[model samples]
Target chain A: MSSPERSSTPMALIVVAWALVVIPLLYGLVQTIRTASALFTG
Target chain B: MAVPGFLARDRIVAKPGFNRWLIPPAALAVHLCIGQVYATSVYKAALVADFESSLTAIGAIFSIAIVMLGLSAALFGTWVDRNGPRAAMFTSACFWSVGFLVGAAGIATNQLWLLYLGYGVLGGIGLGIGYISPVSTLIKWFPDRPGLATGMAIMGFGGGALIATPLSRQLMSLYDSSYDGTAATTPSGSAVALLFVTFGLVYLVFMMFGAAIVRVPAEGWKPDGFDPSTVKSKALVTTDSVSAANAIKTPQFWLLWIVLFCNVTAGIGILEQASPMVQDFFRDGDASLVTAAAAAGFVGLLSLFNMAGRFVWSSTSDVIGRKGIYMVYLGVGLLLYVALATVGSSAVWLFVLLAALIISFYGGGFATIPAYLRDLFGTYQVGAIHGRLLTAWSAAGVAGPLIVNGVLDTQGTPGELVAGDYRIALFIMVGLLAVGFVANLLVKPVASKWHEPKSQTSPTPERSAAR
Candidate 1:
């Protein structure tokens, strides 16, 4: 028997979906580092 | 129901009669390299000295790598299962090698961000993908002894640090002392670059072998001498199978997540400050450099125990039930942390022994859970579920170090200078372990509602058609 379709999002849309997830994660990481540096240096 | 490009169920499950043994060694090779995370401290002093970075700043690099490991693994899990281990393993090796190269570049240029980008993101991705590649395949190949099989593979993951710690230390020393220049203190940049490149190339070759040899067993294939009755006798869950989708919806998945989260967090509290923690407890006004080296050796000793636990304790889970094994891990672990908190370093040997046991259980918990998942859910889509569950690891990677380091940072003085400095952190670990114990207790045999009863009820089409 074949595995059922697990994703309905198109391949292109899936790329966008990943980008959406990854970009926010990177942004938050950058902000954390910046904030940490400021606090420690100050 | 066959999806295009999906391996036939029979093919996916079929036993490759001769090649089964090759998979674990492949897993070990990759694990030995990724295990370098345990030896990160070897570079910490160098990084601080060269870049003028703080302890917390250097720690952030490691934290980023760990957090990314879980995240990338979750992202890559489904792809690994669908595409097979070769693609995933090769990709992991490439990324890991690139990460090392980038890290070397960072050191040469004294650029911190590039090091983070290379080692943290790139190497983390490799870690994530390489870690999961062999897990589901090994479980499927040895369904009767999944705990042992996955443990065999994952034990390598835990042990990787053991091998890496000593090797990295020696390499660093060789690189540092070989310098004949006027600069009396500074390690040669060329030596560091060469070491990184050497490690990267060696790991790439080793990982490629793992990727090449990986093959999924045929569907419904059992080992030639194995009996289902033997497996059932061990008090382990023996389900016909549950799809990954169904498994995720069950409470068992979430409970397992909590158990892992607590176990990892508790262990990391000690692991993050192992060197300092040891020196603080046994302060005798020795030279600072000597004390630091001793502490580093203690860290390496802990790595050995961590590695051993991954194999020995997890293998034990195959005979005892997973829940029963976890009860020991959590219960004993809680007592140990509590003892460490209240005893105030009076019985130093006792402290070391108990801490080692707790750390071993932490590693064991990681090694055993893949097999546990296979037991609760069937091989089908178990990789995906395993991937989703790794988010717990990612969360704990952040939470564990935070609890330990954050407390130490707040305390602001060596434990020797201030009495009971680590008492609060030890108590926190005890509390976390208690939470894990409760979570383990709450894990009931997965409810029948989650099982793929429809698949079970259907006639064995292959058997019937053959007849």
Candidate 2:
């Protein structure tokens, strides 16, 4: 069996990369959810 | 134009031990920005009022943009493949940002043609190139789960409007203090101009980030423990690669085209009329039981379902196989359309549920297609093939609205439509879905004649030299 390749990339880089996209995406989803809630609320 | 050495396909090859997960975020950055194409309605009325033009004239800006998106994708698919993702993405950012800058100028100067030339043409080219840039890279990264990788990126496209709609409102309100973000008020033309500039600069930065981070996989790289033989074992999945040129000549490509056209057409029927359809369905003579606010909420809800379905259903395709998942999208979708036409108006909840489910299938069809192409065509030129297939989307963009609007126009005018007005359109969608279902059934493994020779299947000299 081949040994797993060691990743040189830092974990923080991955987190920062994801955070740049995910934070805005979550904000958008939240905003959409708030607007959509009006359907069931009424 | 010669690609700069730094932006060449050879320069961005991944080294050993690179994490594949980083690619999705890069893909999202571009998609989220281009997906802003859908949120044009936020400032649409302002553009119409400012230009002193009819709604159709202002609406043509969006139509032109969508048409250009389809055209540019088909035209540039192969170029993007040869040049690699970074170059395509950087080029897309330039066109997209400059498009907005020019569009802002047009808006400020009150020149409508400039808006058409800038936002509609230039920004749409950005939309097309940016859309397919990362798809093949993502598929390459996640060979074991092509659908999931693609779903993540395309979901960003759906999510783009969710962000842009609210963001545009806030930005417009900031620029035009006289106009609050409400139906009763429209922002000034100048406000929209500033909003375009802001979107242009912001999207340029975001898309550039994607370009920076995206890297093509090294030759012969695969995820640990992923079995290529298992993938080939599945029905209709090909181990061999087909060039985009030959792919077009095949029956499978055209069948998938028919499949996509039908799916998108049916989905757009509900999406284009989502807000009003809810109110019309529940109308008690003159007064709608559904309020305008609730109807807007229904649109919001459908957008949510649309975004979620892109991720959920495409991911599910990894487990169920692409053909089977599409059967659900088309076969089950036909029954859903029938239920919608017959019983949708009987209850508000039923109407919303049916519409939301149908919208979900529409979105699933979009997100799942790249992976489907990968299955039948292999990754060699799958992105280009995928881009060619998007012509169906452009076609459906016109056909879907035409069928719905044509039928509705015959029955009654806007604001006075009832559920019965939509029966013919819904039935037409049902017929279209039946067509797509049969296309899906006809899909088979690509004939061996279409496959590239063993010599061509390996990484080219330029890519190997990059290493």
Candidate 3:
């Protein structure tokens, strides 16, 4: 079940795919940290 | 014929140039949407008000969803392996979104059974299918780093609550002006109904995006500079593939099941009561030193640790090996429970730090199990095995809270409990972790008798590749 020769992928597409998921993830991380910080201050 | 042609296993095979990295994001899309299950607490109060129901009645919705998650995963696991990730993802999206829409109708009409059928049964099925969809694909793509690959995807499940909690709050606030995202206020049923519709639509887009972009690797593809033979050199790592049907017969699978059940059961002792537990620990005469807000913040902090551990500790398994990593999760976890029971209340920082580490280990156990299974059972039907294993989690979900809450109930009434009231429950968790540690120790490579025949197991050249 050997595959055919590998082909080159566009770097831009890789970056776009990653950013699509990462952006929402970062937003959530920031929100959680902001809420959790109250553990110390409150 | 039930599955569309486009969603077929063969149709979504990676082209020669397909970048393997694109797959993780696609996996994350579905995980993040279904992970909303954990964030159901955000709306628990509103549902109670809407139905004029007791807290237990409302809480049963979440319980039902979790129970169905286990059942559906076990029942459909082999079908998922046979059909492939795309079909599974699409099926999940349809079930999940329709569930929300049906739940919206339930809320709008004040019919509780519809909500139970929709979110609890249908949505739970989505959660089960979505949870395992990408696991085997990720393992195949990064056989050299299976832990890291699965970790990246599963981490989204933990992190999904981080997004959904705040997002749900904001959406509810938008839908109802009277609600301020606080305990003092509750959103109207109409607001919640609209919120479900919005969530249903949004999740449909994200999950469909995942199903559209996901691809299985080409047959026999390997990453540059990665030697498949080297993977077998690791302890308990198998080159041979086992069928999911055969996997359940092995003692190793049951051992890992116990390991996961104990780990999750112990973690939920803290998670199930995070808010009130912190307040009770620091109680001073009539009022606790910790405020309600701080207790909430502690829950948020635990969420961060749980999310971080899923990625960090699971990826570390790639270096340390899965068995070594689980020893740390189970062995050290037992001692941490002891410390938490004894001196955890002496200081707030001490309590937080101990619980955080335990929760991290808990998350690590969940994220690492797939890689562990891949090592022991091989990847022939790992997604199916993973689905089967998750029944342990469902069992733990019931047992963990029952043990904690039952102990607490016997100690004293809810609002009047103190640090002493919790010791018995915490100690019980310590005992559960001890059992898990021994289970982890007992796990070994599956016997050759359990392996699928080579002719039946081997991938054909035209078949899309799986690990």
Order the candidates by DockQ, highest first: 3, 2, 1
Q: Which of the CAPRI classes, incorrect, acceptable, medium or high, describes model 1?
A: incorrect
- DockQ score of candidate 2? 0.55
Model 1: per-residue lDDT, tens digit, B378-423?
Answer: 6765676788789898898889878877787787666443327788
How does candidate 3 score on lDDT?
0.90
lDDT of 1 at B68: 82
Error of 1 at B303 (Å): 1.0
TM-score of each model, in listed order: 0.81, 0.97, 0.97
Q: Is candidate 1 or candidate 2 better by lDDT?
A: 2
Off by over 4 Å in 1: A1-42, B1-16, B174-186, B229-236, B284-290, B410-412, B415-419, B453-467
DockQ of each: 0.02, 0.55, 0.66
Give me the TM-scores for chain A across all models, comma-separated. Answer: 0.54, 0.77, 0.82
lDDT of 3 by residue, B197-298 (tens): 998999999999999889898777788899988999888999898878778888998999999999999999999999999999999988999988889889
Per-chain TM-score of chain A in candidate 3 equals 0.82
Instruction: Name the lDDT value of residue B293 in candidate 1.
Output: 41
In model 1, the Cα lDDT at residue B258 comes to: 93
